[model samples]
Target chain A: MFRYILRRILYMAVTLFIIATVSFFLMKMLPGSPLKAEDKLSEEQREIVLEKYGLNDPVPVQYVRYIGGLVKGDLGISFTFDNTPVTKILMDRIGPSAQLGAQALLIGTFLGILLGLIAAISHNGALDYTSTILAVLGTSIPSFVFAGLLQRYLAVEWELFPVALWGTFEHTILPTVALMIFPMATAARFTRTEMIEVMGSNFITTARAKGVSEYGIIFKHGLRNALIPLVTVMGPMAVSLMTGTLVIEKIFAVPGIGEQFVTSVMVNDYPTIMGTTLLFAFLFVLIILVIDLLYVLIDPRIRLTGGES
Target chain B: MSKLLEVKDLKVSFNTYNGEVQAVRGVTFDLNKGETLAIVGESGSGKSVTSMALMQLLPKPHGYVKSGEILFEGEDIVKKSTRDMQKIRGKDISMVFQDPMSSLNPTMKIGNQIMEGLIKHQNMNRTNARKKAVELLELVGIPHPETRLNQYPHQFSGGMRQRVVVAIALACNPKILIADEPTTALDVTIQAQILELMKDIQKETDSAIIFITHDLGVVANVADRVAVMYAGKIVEIGTTDDIFYNAKHPYTWGLLGSMPTLDSDEEELFAIPGSPPDLLNPPKGDAFAPRNEFALEIDTVMEPPMFKVSDTHYAATWLLHEDAPKIEPPESVQRRMQGFSNTGSKDGEK
Candidate 1:
């Protein structure tokens, strides 16, 4: 078990390194130059800006310098955001994004699982039909579109929630819903399929034959096995929700890394863009690793010598 | 000789897109107290369906019992409500399935699976249930019962898992135990161990067992009386000696002849010709008539009613008609039957 954990950690480190390398070079490869944004600046000023950020050096040299600075916990300065260090900017916005993402995931997963259980138990009944329809709507409609609709009706007409901005928990309602739609749909569909399959398995028949109650057969025997596949997708689903919430965050003006990432990309802010990408990639990798560990916990079958794929 | 369970005119069918598949025809059997009745048949012979119907545990929306009266301890189980049925299940009657791995919940610990019935039907608390679970495990012949209780189903070997299943079935001291091909999935050595364990447990508990399988060898060892099912109906049923020695049904004869004998000089064992009739469009008369070598003209025109060969022996065959000529069995079969009877008598004497 210790060896399994050790291997997972080592794999995580390698994954992080790959993400950092890709993000660093990809930011450099974007078409627009960072200095070009300050078009009115004199030749000397432009040269000074390039020299300060080490952009005057070759790409390889700049990469080495950037990696060296990263080693020292320095994220350098944002090109377009009044010379602020990218790490400082990320630190300020991580809270709202993390909050919104966690809320969305929690609400989506809980409700999805509940709805899925109802759907599976009811089977061909109204609950199952309703859940299927809801999942379809959630998956088909994009978060941005959902956010826009919520802002128009729920916020504008009915006035159920604030239209934009992040402060109190009330401000999180629209954007969280927007962020939750896809994962909720995914969770519902996955749980429903898994639950139905598990319910049909021979073990369930064995359970029923034992004179176990229908509820016991479902929750204890059926649901536990059904959760294996759901848990497998949880890592990628969570990270996707957090990192991909940029459109929702922007529409709602929620101060998150997603919003920061949009601003960094728009202004060609090299340091901020690289930092956010690296952080998001790191978070994605970390969540996936955590999910791998969780798989072993949920189902011991995966805790075999080599570890799960 | 009081009947513990009686199944009357049981018929089970599944509704598919093409048509209704009649999996079980008018099958009837009775289990007496402390008696082990083996229902022997090839695959798709409806032995499992008959058992599942008795418990009212058939899968819904597709498969259902068309007509049946499963009287368990004098009450009609088919007419009982789901709630009443729950009270009967696990408490009065329990079942162990063919696949031990699939029969157990993979996610659950072996102990909890065993304790579930105790807590549900017996109203035992968690603490008491756990203690009883260890005892039950030990009772089923599993070692280190205390530590093993914490392990999941996957941790145990195939035979051990079956033992765990047996322990779970016996947890509430059920009156009737239905073992549906329990030893089919295990290796030969494990199969013997499970059979011995079951026989031992049966002696202690005195529970009537419905042992369903295709292996005649197992039937010879475990069954008190044997029912040979064909297509969906019981073609023959008798005491082990009666079935092996004075078997009346042609299907039963075919089955016995198909089995390999040590003394037979034939290079290859005799095999029953043709496959089981498709349940979707079964024959109008006897389902096994086309395959029976000794089939009479009436065998293809009408289904045979049960004919009593002795006080405890009965068979469904047109050849058993009163005016029908007395035909001798094959010499090879007679020789094998003599050998079997001699060995069985010796064992009984010992």
Candidate 2:
């Protein structure tokens, strides 16, 4: 097991490097230049800005310098945000984003699994139909639309949850729901379909034949096997949640990394853009690594080499 | 001996989108204590369905026992509530399914799979159940019982997994063990070993076993009495000796002739021509009339009830009617019958 974990960690490092390199070049290839945004400034101001960020150097040289600063735990400085270090700005805002993302994931996965199990067990009954409808609605409506509708009716008209902000628990509710809508829907649909398929497998029939209770058959035998497919989706789902929270954060006025990421992109703030992209890429890689490790824990059949030992 | 299980007029059907498919139609049988009764039939002949109905394990909302009286020790199990039926399952009537790999839980240790029933039904404590689980592992001839107890189903071979399943079924010492094609998924050598092990276990436990299979060779070795099923009904039933020797039903004759025998000189074995009748709109009279070569005019118009050839032997065929003309089985079947009779005489002399 220790060897397995070490191998996974080594793979994670390789994966992160590939992501960083791709993101670096991809951002450079975008239409607008970070220096071009200062067109309204005088030649002297632009020169000072270019020199300060080392952008006066060749693209390869700048890339090397950026990678060196990244390795030393530095993210240079944000061009549009009063020239503060990009890392410091991100660190300050990361807490709200992390908390919101965690809460949304927790609530979404928990309720999704619960409702999915209900749908599978009750199969073709009212509960199944209702959950299916709810999942469709959750997936169909965009997060911003969901947030807008909830803010309009649940907050504005009924005056239940606060419309916007990210301080108290009440302020986080609307944004969390909005952010969770897609993940929850995807998880529910995946889990429901997988559970239904697993429940019909021969092993479940064997369990029932052994006089194992209906609950035991469905949960103990069925759910664990069903989770293999569900686990595979979690990595991509988390990445989507982290990156896709831009619209949700804007609507709720939540000062998250996604909101900052959008702001940085609009102004072509190179340092902040690079920092947030690296952070998002790192998060995606980490989630995928965790999910890969989880495969072993959930199923003994999957070895580190991806074959039965 | 007293009857241990009596399934009378048992009928089972599945409600499909097309229509209701009558899977098992008016199947009846009795199993005596310490005896092995084999139900022989091809696939979809309602052999497995009949056994599932007896255990009340039919898939609900789609499959159900339309009508039946499954009496275990004189109590109607069919009429029992689910809560009450739980007491009988695993405790009184246990079943070993066809596929052993699927039968055993893949994730759980072999010990826990065996101990599950002992813990739940027998009310044995964890420690005691664990100890009993080891004994069961040893009982089923699994080597290195201590080490194997911790191993999962995937670790074991096919035959070994079946042994683990059988061990689980025997955990509570059920009065009747229903083995539905238990060795069907095993290799030839392993199949023999499993059958022998089952016979030994049956001797030790004296539990009446209901063995369902399509293999005639398996019936020859393990079964005491055999019931030949064709198209959702028992076409013939008798002692193993009677059915193998004086088998009366044309379907049984077809099955016997179709089977490859050790002493047969024929280059080609007989094969039954037509498929089983469609149960959605089953034939008006005999379901097997279309396939039976010796089927009479009346056989197509009226279904023949069970005709007693002896005190313990019965067959469902119009040929057995007093007024009907006598017809012998084909030349190859008669020759095989002669070979079997010679072998029977030689064995009797010993």
Candidate 3:
């Protein structure tokens, strides 16, 4: 298992390097510079400004220097955002996104699985139809639309939550819910499908023959097997939530990295954009590794490696 | 002998997209307290349906007993509610399913699988259940029972997993064990061992076993009585001797002819002429008539009643009518019947 993890970390490093390289070049390739506002400057004056930021250097040289900065754990300085260090900016913005994502993840997975179990156990019944419809709606309706609806109804009309912004726990509720819908729906659909299959498996019949309580058979045996596939689907998704929901964070004014990511890209803030992309890619690979480990944890049949002897 | 289970005209069917599938059509049988009754048939022959109906584990609300009386200890299990069936299952009646590969939950520990029944039905605490589970693993011939208990099903081989399944079924000393082709998925040598284990367990517990399998060769090893099912109905049922030697139904003859006896030196093994009839729209008369070479003219229009051959033997065949022509069983069947006796004498009851 140790060797397997080490090998995965190596692969993760390679993957992040490639993502960083691609996003760096992709950002550099875009027209219009971070100096779009400086276009009317006198040629001599523009040169001074470019030289000050080392923008006068060739692209390859800039890439090398950027890579050097990366190795030293410095994401360079953001061109926007008062020239703050990109890493510090990312760290500062992480808390709200992480909290919202974690809350949504915990509540979404639990409720989705519960709803899915009810649907599968009462298959073809009213609850099954209800869950199916809800899954379809959740997948179809965009989170921003749901955000608007939640604001209008939940905050504006019902006065249950603050309309928008990142402040109190009440303000966090609407955006967290908006961010959670997709994961919950995906979880519900997958759980329903997997649980139905698990419930029909021969072991479940064996459990039934053993006179296991309905709850025991469904929760202990059926759910454990069903959760394997659910974990697979939920892995990459969890990473996205950790990064923050771009439109959702904007709509709710949560001041998360999602808004920063967009603004950095628009102004061609190379360091900030590359840093964000790298963070996302790193989390993607890391969560995938975590998911692989989860497979071993949930199912004994899934061995990590012969190295673990 | 006292009767343990009496299934009277038990009919089962499933509601499919096409229509109602008559899986089991008015089947009747009796299981003695300590005997192994083998329900033998091809796939879709309702042998499995009979067993599932006994346990009330048929996939619902699709497969259901259309009409039946499964009398257990003088009470009809057919009328028993699902809640009541729960109490009876695992405690008084348990089952060992076919395909040990999938019958045991893969994610669960072998110990917990065995202990589940003990803790649920026997009301034993975790410690007692754990001790009993270790004993069961030992009884099933598993080595290092203590260490093996915590391992998952994947850690065990197919035969060993099947042993665990049997151990789970026997944990509470159920009075009746319905083993649905428990050895069908096992290796030939493993098959022999499992048969021996079940027989031994039966001797110790005196539990009636309703063993379902299509293998006539396997039936000879453990079954006290044999039931030949065709198209969801029992066409022939008798003692091992009656079914093997004095068989009265042509279907039974076909089944015997199909099996290869050890002493037989036939150029080719015989196969029954046609597959079993579609139960969705079962034929009018003897469901086996279309495949039966001796099918009478009246077979197409009417179903034959079970004909008594001896006190313990009966067959459902028009050939058994008193006025019917006296035609001997086919040459291949007679040769098999003779060869079986030779092998039986030589091998001393294989």
The best candidate by DockQ is 3
Clashing pairs in 2: none
List where candidate 1 sits over 4 angstroms from the true fold: A1-7, A304-309, B265-267, B346-350
Docking quality (DockQ) for each candidate: 0.78, 0.56, 0.84
lDDT of 1 by residue, B258-309 (tens): 7775566763566789999999998977899898777778878888899999
Q: Quote the positional error of residue B254 for candidate 3 in Å.
A: 0.6
Cα lDDT tens digits for candidate 3, A1-309: 888999989899888888878888888888888876675888998888789788899988999998889888999898887679999999999787778888888888888888898899889899999999998898778788888999999999999999988888988899989888878888899999999999999999999999998889988899999999999888866975665477788888888788778888889887888888888788789889989998999988888774565
Interface RMSD, Å, model 3:
0.6
Model 3 CA deviation exceeding 4 Å by range? A240-244, B342-350
TM-score for chain B considered on its own, for each of the candidates:
0.97, 0.97, 0.97
Chain A agreement with the truth for model 1, given as TM-score: 0.94
Q: B9-110 in candidate 2: lDDT tens per residue? A: 999999999999999999999999999999999999999999888888888889998997899999998898886777777888889989987777666778
Per-candidate RMSD, Å: 2.1, 2.0, 1.8
Reference-based TM-score, model 1: 0.96
Poorest stretch of ten by lDDT in candidate 3 chain B: B341-350
Candidate 1 local lDDT, A1-309, one digit each (tens) = 667778877887788678778887877788877765467998899888778777889988888888888879998888777768888999999999888889999899988888888899889899899999999999888788988999999999999888999888899888988889888988999999999999999889888988988889888888889989998788878977976588888899988889989988977888888888888877887787778777778896666476443
